[model samples]
Target: MKKTILLTLLVVSSFQNINSQEKREKDLLTSRKWYIKYMKFGENKREISDKTKNENWMLFNQNGKAEITTQGIKSIEDWNFGKKHEIINISEDGKFTEYKIEKLNESELVISRKYLNKTTTLGLKK
Candidate 1:
C-alpha cells in the first residue's frame, strides 16, 4: 500500500512539472514581440534588409491571436501550440501552416517549416 501511494504521488508530481513547463514556455512565447532577423532556405541564408531588424515582426497573444507585420502591413491570424508544444499552428482564412520549433528562449526564437522540397527557417529576436 505504501509503494502504491508513493507511485501515485510520483506520477502526479511529474504531471504537474510537465504542465508548469508548458505554461512557462507559452508565457515566454507570448510575452514580447519578436522581430525577424534572418531567414534560411535550405542551404541559402538571407538577412533582413533593415539593419535595425524591426522591419518585420510577429506578436503572439495568449488568446490565440497573432499579428504578423511585414513591410508595414499587418495581418491578423489565429495561432495555437501543438499537443507536444513542439509545433505552432497558424491559420488565416481557411489555410493553415505548421511551424516546427527549432529553438525558443526569452530573447530568441527559431522556427522551421517545409516549403516545397526545401525547409525554410526564420530566426527572430526580441
Candidate 2:
C-alpha cells in the first residue's frame, strides 16, 4: 500500500509539472507579437525609435518558431523557454542566444543577457 501511494504521488507530481510548464508558455507566448520598448546595453540605454531610426520586434508562434524583425528585416528562428521558464533560447543559422527572463506578464516582457563583460537588458511591450 505504501508503494502504491508513492507511485500515485509521483504521477500527480508529474502532471502538475506538465501543467505548470504549459501555463508558463501560454502566459508568455500567447500575445504573438512584442515590440521592443528599449534596450540597455550596460550603462547605455537605447529607446525605441530613437535617433538611430531602428525598429525591433519579436514574434512568438505556438509552433515553437520565432521571428525577430529589425530594420524591416525578419530572421526566422526556433525558440523555447528554458527549464522552469527562467530563460528564452533563440536559435538561428546554427547560432543560439539565450536571454534570461527578468519579468513577463500580459503586457510586458523583460529579458537580459551578459556576454564579454557587457550586459544587455531588453524591455518589450505587447
Candidate 3:
C-alpha cells in the first residue's frame, strides 16, 4: 500500500513538472519578437546584403489571430492554443501559405513551409 502510494505521488509530480515546463516554453514563445536574417543560397555567393537583416513582429490578437509583418510584407496567421500553441496557416494579401513553428530553445524559433520549401530560424529580440 505504501509502495503504491509512493508510485502514484511520483507519477503525479512528474506530470506536474512536464505541464509546468510546457507552459514556460509557450509563454516564452508568445512573448518574443521574431526577426528575419536572409542569406544567399549558393556556395559562391559574393556578399550577404546588409539589408537582409530586417525587423519583424509577430502579434497575437485576443481572438486567436496572429499577424506577422516586416517592412513591405504583411501576413495574417491563424493560431490555436491549448496544451500547445501552433501556427496553422498564413495569408498574405490573397495568397495562402501553410507554416509550422517549433521552439528550438527559449530564445529561438524554427518556422517551416512545405510549398515554399523553406525553413527559417528566428531569434528572439531582447
Best candidate (score: lDDT): 1
The TM-score that candidate 1 achieves is 0.90
TM-score of each: 0.90, 0.80, 0.54
Lowest lDDT block of 10, candidate 2: 47-56
Over the stretch 1-126, how does candidate 1's per-residue lDDT look in tens digits?
Answer: 999999999999999998998898899999999999899999999888766556599999999999998767789999988887788988867577999999999999999999999999999989
Question: Which parts of model 2 are misplaced by more than 4 Å?
Answer: 2-11, 14-18, 50-54
What TM-score, to 2 decimals, does candidate 3 have?
0.54
* Comparing 1 and 3 on lDDT, the stronger one: 1
Instruction: Tell me the deviation in Å of residue 14 in model 1.
Output: 1.7
Per-residue lDDT over 89-114 for candidate 3, one digit per residue giving the tens place of the 0 to 100 score: 55555555554664445556655544
lDDT of each: 0.90, 0.82, 0.54
- Cα RMSDs of all predictions? 1.6, 2.9, 5.2
Per-candidate count of clashing residue pairs (backbone under 3 Å): 0, 0, 0
